[model samples]
Each structure stands twice: as structure tokens, then as C-alpha cells.
Target: MSAEIVVLLVVFVGLLILNVPVAVAIGVSALAMIATLGHVPTAFLMAERMSNGINSFPLLAIPFFVLSGVLMGQGGMARRLMDFAAAMVGRLPGGLAYVNTLSCMLFGAVSGSAAAAVSSIGGFMIPQMKEKGYSKEFAVALTATSATTGLLIPPSNIMIVYAVVSGGVSVAGLFMAGVVPGMLIGFLLMVASAVLMRVGGHSKAGVAQVPRFWPAFFGALPSLLLIFIVLGGILGGVFSPTEASAIAVAYAVVLGGFFYRQLGWADVPKILLIAAKTTSVVMLLIGASQAMSWVLTYENIPQMVSEAMLTLSANPLMVFLLINVLLLLVGTFMDMTPAVLIFTPIFLPVVVELGMHPVHFGIMMIANLCIGLCTPPVGTCLFVGCSVGGTTIARTTLPAIPFFLAMLVGLLLVTYVPWFSMALPGWLNLF
Candidate 1:
């Protein structure tokens, strides 16, 4: 590596070790490297790189999705979705666990945020699980793991970031690719919960039984229709992902304010403020990441990394396995957004050289990073779940073991079975 690249890497590590916020760390580190190189005008570089980062049309999807998720989250749509999910699965062994998984899946469809899912769904169900005799640690663990489904499901903001960073790959296609695999992950989690409950000799909670299918079906209809509207619009090409997000916001307003009667006029300002705040944070990160990415490209860092990886493993399978192990380790230390931002450019070319489709790699990468959000030492989703469930990190980590295994299985399936990420997009000719 050149002196600039070496200094850039050092600055990044040093900033991170100092516990600087990720966006600032990235921006400052890039700036430090640029200054050290003294090869470019700082003002010109700053404006150009920042503009390049936020200039994509597809990137407009981020704010819309953020607003839509905020509207649904604030309007109490999650509660209804959880009620429907609980009704459908609440009678089985480890009923609340199943409910947690299913609810996260449903909530993921709408929210596209793991933290939001855990806060809203886990807040409601963890207490219920505890009351039903489920251990507090197990409840927290299940909720944390299931919340990761939000990253896998359609409408994921992280996927939008990946698409933007990956040279304008289809956001709609990525969304479609995520659907089946996301559900599969959720399903496997449920199965794991079932097996774990049986092994631990845990019985049904015996809470007030759900009435029947029809009631549950009707109750969940509004949220289900929201999913159909968003996904159908995207898949059918009726709207771009950005437009689809606008539609989602409108739908959430009607459903929450009018149909479900959960949200009122009084809630509008707070919802807007929340959405705006979230959009600002995400957009700033995107802008800063763009600058850092530009610096990396200018330094030929991606090419160097790709060449190094190729030398390390000529076999494609070995290369992929090695990438997975690296990503898992990175996920443990870094938050998902920065990880995706910093690594996507570096890894995309490596995968392409190994004859992997960008779409497949995108899904696999997102899922792997999603697992990191639940891992220890800095797992954002795990911390959120623990807080919501009123448990400690140590307690929650035990229950996370089985769920982690289930996610690993899903990750391997997506990695090896390319069709899991490609079938729908291929049929639709969306590549």
C-alpha cells in the first residue's frame, strides 16, 4: 500500500479506538489522509465527494422509506401486526417465542429497521413472555435475533445504501431478492425456538387463547395490505422504490389514522420530526461515506484489496468462505452502516471476479452484517432488545446461541444457493 493508504487506515483505526461516532470518524479519517497526501485541493475534494455521495436518484428512496417506517412505528401498526402474529402462533410450544419471530418478520416488512422492530415488538411481547414463564434471557435473546429480519426483508434502508454504493444496481430487484430469504431466516428462527423449547422442556404459555383464523386474518389485513402495496408496486414496476416509499407513507397514514384509528392529527408533528431526524442522520452518513469511498478509489484501495484476496485464494469457494469469516469479525466490531459503506466497494469487485452476481452478493453481505448487529461487544440490536426486555447482555447472549446458528444456516443457504437471492429477480428480468 502507498503511504496515503497506510495513513488512512491508521487514522480510521485510531478514530474508532477513540470511540468517535462512525460518520465523523470516516469523514475525519479521509480528510486526514487527503491532507497527508497533499495531492488535491481540500475544498474541491470535499464538495465534489460529498455531492457525488448524495446525488443518486435511487438514494432518494432512503428518506421516503424512513418517513414511512416512522409513520407506521408511531401510529401503532406494530401492535396490530404483533396481535395478529400472536393469534396465529400463540398456541404452539414456545408460543411467545414463535410470536416474537413472526411478529418481527411482519414488522420488518413495514419498518425495515431492526431497532424499531425490537423496541416496538419486544416492548410488547417480552413482558408477556415473562408472565407466561419464559425466561427473561430467552425472551430477550429471541427478540434480538428476530429483529434482524428487518434487515433482510424488503424495504430495507441498508439495501438501499448497498444499491446506491454498488453503482446503481436495482433497488427494486434487491427488495425482491430479499423477500424469500428473509422469510426463510424467520422460519428457521421459529423452528429453532420450537426445538429449544422442547429441549428445555418448556410448555405452552396458556395465555388467553386466540379466537380463530378469521379474526386474526381480518385484524392483520391492513398491515398485510401495506406490504402488498409496497412490494407489488416495486415488483410490478408501477413505481420506483422511491415512489413506492411515498405510497407506503400515504398508506400508513390512512391505515393508522383512519382505518385502525390508532393515530390522530395530534401525532403528525412528532412523526414528522422523528422521520426528519432519522433522515438527516442517514443522509449525513451517506455523504461522509461517499467522501471516504472516493478517497479509497482515488488511492486504488479496492483494486489492491481485490488483488490481494485473489492471491490469497484462487478457489472461489475458499474465497467466499474467507470473505464470510472476515465479515463476521467486522460485524462484531463495527456497526452495519459503516461496515457496508467501507467494505461494499472493496468486496463487490472481489465477488464479481469470482463469478458472483452483485445482487446475490448484496443479499449475502446484508444478511451477514445483520447477524453482526446481534453479536456481542457492540451489537446494536442486542443492546436494544436487552433494554426492551429488561435483561442484561450476558443473560441475553445465552439464548442468542441457537438463533445465531439458525441465521448462520440461512446465510450459508443464500451464499451457496444463488437462486435464493436471484430467482424472482431473474424471472422478472430485473438484473
Candidate 2:
């Protein structure tokens, strides 16, 4: 670690401990480093880097995706997806758990926002699970953990962020690459929940009643089609990812307003305001992280850190393990957007040097960070899920353990097994 890196870490950590907002903490730390080094005036560097940070065309996809998620989430999509999931698995032993997991996965696939998934699916499933006799902590844990699979699924805002920061990894390829790994994690979560429920002595009495398969499927069909419209257009080269994002927003409006009749013109202002707020926060984080990345690069921090990690281990597996561990720790403390922004530039060079494909590493990195969203201190989904379930972090921590372990297991597989991340994109010739 260089003196500059030490200063950056100290200031950043100190600000975090003082309860400053994450974006502010990052920007302040970057500014402090510039002042300490006296290499460049703080204002000029901050202005240039921060403005350049959010100047990319690809970033436009983020706001569109966020708006679309808000639209679909409020459009009665969650209940219909729940019905469809229940129709698929609600009669199995410990069915409500399966329903919650499956519904979250479906909602995530369409909505492409993990927080939206947690709020929408958790809002419904947590209460339903409690009524079915599942513990509140377990319900929050399950909802929070399962919701993160969305970030791994297609049309993800975080994937757009990664695509931009990664320099040139195809957005469509990243989207395709994530499909199997995302589903794999969701399946692992479902199995973990089912097995834990069985071990905890939940009887068959908790099984839920679902509507007929055809009705449920047809009801959710409009919401489901948005997935194909957005992903298919991008993959087919009918549009770029940014164009696809706009199309997704259009589709979401049509589905929510006309097709479903759940969303009205009266609801547009609130949805836009919510989307604007989310987008502003995310863009600010990107700008701040960009400044941080620039400072790190100017100080040669990435090269130094990369060299240190490579010195620690010449073996690819060991180096990857070291990176994954660091990312997991970073995830616990930082939000995913800024983490992806700041670390992608630093760690990507090392992985490319090791011969790992950028798309594979992107999936691996996102999957690894998803676990952090369910952990403590700054786990976004954890806090949201707990609030939705009317529970506290302290109460939810124990029950969340198994699912956390399950995500860790999935992350290990994603890290070590290239096939899970590479198969789909390769088949599509997406590279």
C-alpha cells in the first residue's frame, strides 16, 4: 500500500464511521488525497474526473432501466408473478418458501432491480410467509437474499455500470452471460430455504394454494414479455443496449397502463420522481467513484495493488480467491454501484492478465457482491427486507446465515467454474 492509498482509506473509512453519505465519503476521500499529494488542484481534478465519470453514452441505460423497474414494480406485477410461481411450485412441501423465492426470481428477471424486487416481492411475500407460519426473520432473510439474483439477471443497471467501467465488454454479452449464474443462485437459495425449513420441522401444513397454471401464467404473461422484448432486441442487434432500455421503458408503460390496467396516468408523476431520485443518487455515486478511480490511477494505486496481489500468488486460483475475498469485504461496506465503478478499473487489469474473460469476471464480481447486499452494516436489501417484514437486523441475522452461506457457495462456483458464466454468451456468439 502506498502512502496515498493509506490516506485515501483512512479518510474514506473515517467519513463512513462518521455517518456521512457514501457518495460524500468517496468524494471527500478523493479530494483529501489530491490535497495531501499536491499533484493537482483539488477543484480542477474533482470537476474534470467527476464530470468525465458520468459522461458516457452507455450510462443512459441506467435511468431508463430504473424508471422501467419502478413502473413494472408498481404495476401489480409482483402479485401476478407470485401467482405464476405458486402455480408452478406452491403445492410442494414448504411451498410458500419456494413461492417466495420463485416469485422474487421472476420479478427480478423482469424488473432488473434488486431493491425493487426486495420492496415489491418482500412487501407481499414476507407477510404471506408469516401468515403461513414461517418465522419473520427467515422470511426477511429469504426475501432479501433471493432478490439479489435480479442484479445477475439481464437488463441490470449494475451490469450497465460494469459495462461502462470495463471499457468495452459487450453489454448484451454481459446480460447473456449472467443468465445461468443468476438462475443457479436462485435455485441454490430455493434449495437452501426448503432444506432449512424441513430441518426446522415445518410440517406440510404450510403448503399454499395457488390458482390454476394457465390463468396464473396468462396473467403474468405481459410482465414476462418485457424480458424478451428488452433482451431479445439487444441480442438480435435490433437495438443497442441503450435503445433497448428506452424500449423497455416504453414496454413497461404499455404493460402497466393499458395491458394490465393497474397503472394510470395519475401515477406517472410519482413514478418519474422516484426514478429521478434513484438515478440522481446512482449517477452521483458514479461521478464520485470516477473521481476516486482517477485519483487511484494518478497515484498508480491500481498498478501497485495489482502487483501486490500478483506477488501474493502467481497461481490463478489463489489470485482469484484473494480478489473475491476483497470484493466481498468491500461489498459489505460500500454500495454496489460505486464498488463496481472504483474496483472494476483496479481489479480488471489483474484478471485480464490472468487470462480470465472480462464477461466472466463481470459475472463473478457481481455475484460476489450480491452476497454483500444480504450482509450487515450496509446491506441494502437486508435493511429493506427487514423493514418490510417488520423485523430488525439483529433479529434477522441468525436466520439469514444459511442463505448467506448459500450465496457464498454460489459465488465460489461462479468464480471457479467458467462454464456457468461463459456458456450462454459463447453459444450466442456474443463476443
Candidate 3:
């Protein structure tokens, strides 16, 4: 490696080790490399790249989606969804566990944020489950693992970010590709939860008393309508992803603030403020990561890395195995958004060269990282789940083992079975 490239890696890794902000670590490291190479003036090039990074029209979706999630979460939507999920699954053996899993899938799909799922679903379900005699560890582990389904489901902010970083690959296609895999993961987690319940002899201990389906369904219908309006419109070609996201904001407001009458004018400003702060962090990370990506590309780092990966194995299965293992480790330390921004550019080329579809690869990357969301060190969902479940990290990790294995199995299924991701997009002829 060139001295300049070595300096970039060293500085970036060093900053991350020192616990600096991810955006600062990326921007400072890139600037240091630019100065070391003595090319263009560091300030001018860095400024140019940073501005250019967030200039895309599609980037607007992040804020709208985030605002919608905040609105839905703060109003009565979470409780309504919980009631609906309970009605749907409450009669089964280990009913509360199924409700927890299904609620996370539903709530996560609507909000497009696993953090929201963990906080919202876990807040209610964990206490209820504990009252029903389930262990605190089991409640937290299941909630944390199931919440990650949001990342794989439609209307996902992470997928929007992936589409932007992959140079305008279809957001619609990526959304289509995620559905089956996301549903599959939800089912696997439910199965694990059911098994855990049977082993603990809690199968019949706390059966939920569900209301009539019609009553609960009608109660939750308004909040549920938001999903159909947004995703159905996108799939039907009625609106672009960004337009759907904008409509989601309006719908969430009307449903939460007006029709439900749960949220008032007083709540609007707080929601907007939170959304703005989150958007700022996400946008800054994108810009900084883009600047670093450009520097690496100019230095031929992507090409070199791609060549090295191919030399490891010409076999497709072995190549993906190695890639999945690498991404799993990467998830341990990095948060999802910055990880996607930084690593997508690096690995996209390698996978495409191996004749893998970018859409499939995007889903694969998100699925692998979903496991990390429940892992320790820096997992956001992990923190939220533990906090809400009233358990410590060490207490939750052991119970989380079975669910994590279920996630790995789902990841492999998505990775190896192209149809798991590709079928919907193909039926829609999206590619």
C-alpha cells in the first residue's frame, strides 16, 4: 500500500478506536490522506465531496420517513398494533411470544426503524410477558431479535440509504426484494420463541385473552392503513419511493394527531425536532463516508480489494461465505447507516463481478447486519431492548443465542436462495 493510503487507514481506524464520531473520523481521515498525497488543497476537495454527497433528490426520503416513524410511535399506534397482533396470534400456544414477534414485524415494517420497534413493542410486551411468568431474558432477547425485521421489510430507511449509495439502483426493486426474506426471518424468530416457551413449560401458563378479531382489527385499522397506502402505492407504480415517504408523513400525522386524537398540536414540534436531529446525523455520515469513498476510488483501493477477494476463491459459494462472515464482524462495531455508506461502495463491485445481482446483495447485507442490531458492543437495538426489557446485556446475551442462530439461518437462506429475494421483483418485472 502507498504511504498515503496507509495513513488514511491508520488515522480512520485510530479515530474510531478513540470513540470519535463516525462522521468526524471519516472526514478527518480523508482530509489527512488528501494532505499527505499533496494533490488538491485539502479544504477545497473535502468541501466539494461533502456537499456533493448529499445532493441527490432521493436523499430527501430519510427525513420524511424518520418523521413519520416518530409520529406513529408517540401516538396510540403502538398500542393499537399490539391489540391487533394479540387478536391475530393470542390463541396459539405460547401466545404472548407470538404476539411479541408478530408485533415487531408489523410495527417495524410501518416505522422502518428497528429502534422504534424495540422501544415501542418492548415497552409494552416485556412487562406483560414478565407478568405472565416468562423470563426477563427471554422477553428482551425475542423483542430485540424480532425488531430487526424492520430493516429488511419495505419502506426501510436503510434500504433507501443503500439505493442512494449504490449509485441509484432502484429503491422500488430493493423494497420488492426484501419482503419474503423479512417475513421469513419473522417466522424463524417466532419458531424459536415457541420452542423456548415449550422448554420452559410456559406454553399454557399465560394464554392471552384475545377479543373478537373484528373488534381488534377495526380498532387498529387506521394505523394499519398507513402501510397499505404507502407500499401498495409504490408497488402499483402510483408514486415513487420518495413521494410515498412524503405521503407517509401526512398520513401518520392525520392518523395519530387527528383521527386517533391521541397526539395533539403539542406533540408536532417535538417529533419534528427529533426527526431533524436524526436526519442531521444520518446526512452528515453519508457526506463524510462519500468523501472517503471518493478518495479510496481515486486511489484504486476498490479495484485492489476486489482482485484480492477473487484470488481467495473462484467458487461463488465460498466467496459469499467469506463475505457474510466479514459483514457479521463489521456489524459488531459499526452502526448500520455509516456501515452501509462506507462498505457498500467497497463490496458492491466485488459481488457484481461475481455475477451476483445488486438487489440481492443489498438484501443480504441488510439481513446480515440485522443480527448485529441485537448483538453487543454498539448494537442500537440491543441497548433499547435491554433498557425496555429491564435486563442487563450479560443477562440478555445468553437467551439471545437461539434467536441469533435463527437469524443466521435466515441470512443463509436469503444469501443462497436467490428466489427468496428475487421473486417479487421478478414478478413485478422491476429489474
Task: Residues 1-431, candidate 3: write the lDDT tens digits.
Answer: 89989999899999999999988999999999988878688899999999999998899989999999998888788888888999998888789999999889989988888999999999999999999999999999999999999788888999999999999889999988998999999999988887888999988854457867898899888877887888789889899888999999999888887888888888778888999999999999999999999999989988988999999988889989998999999999988888899889988999999999999999999999998888999888989998887789998899999999999999999999999999999999899
TM-score each candidate.
Answer: 0.97, 0.97, 0.98
The window of 10 residues in a row where model 2 has the poorest summed lDDT is 201-210
Which predicted model would earn the best TM-score? 3
Please provide the root mean square deviation of candidate 1 (C-alpha atoms, Å): 1.4
- Residue 178 alpha-carbon offset, candidate 1, angstroms: 0.6
After superposition of all CA atoms, the RMSD between model 3 and the true structure is 1.0
Q: After superposition, how far is residue 68 of candidate 3 from its true place, in Å?
A: 0.5
Cα lDDT listed for each candidate: 0.86, 0.90, 0.90
Clashing pairs in 2: none
RMSD of each: 1.4, 1.4, 1.0
Residues 93-127 of candidate 1: C-alpha lDDT, one tens digit per residue:
66778888898888977887888999999888889
Model 3 regions more than 4 Å off: none
Clashes of 3: 0
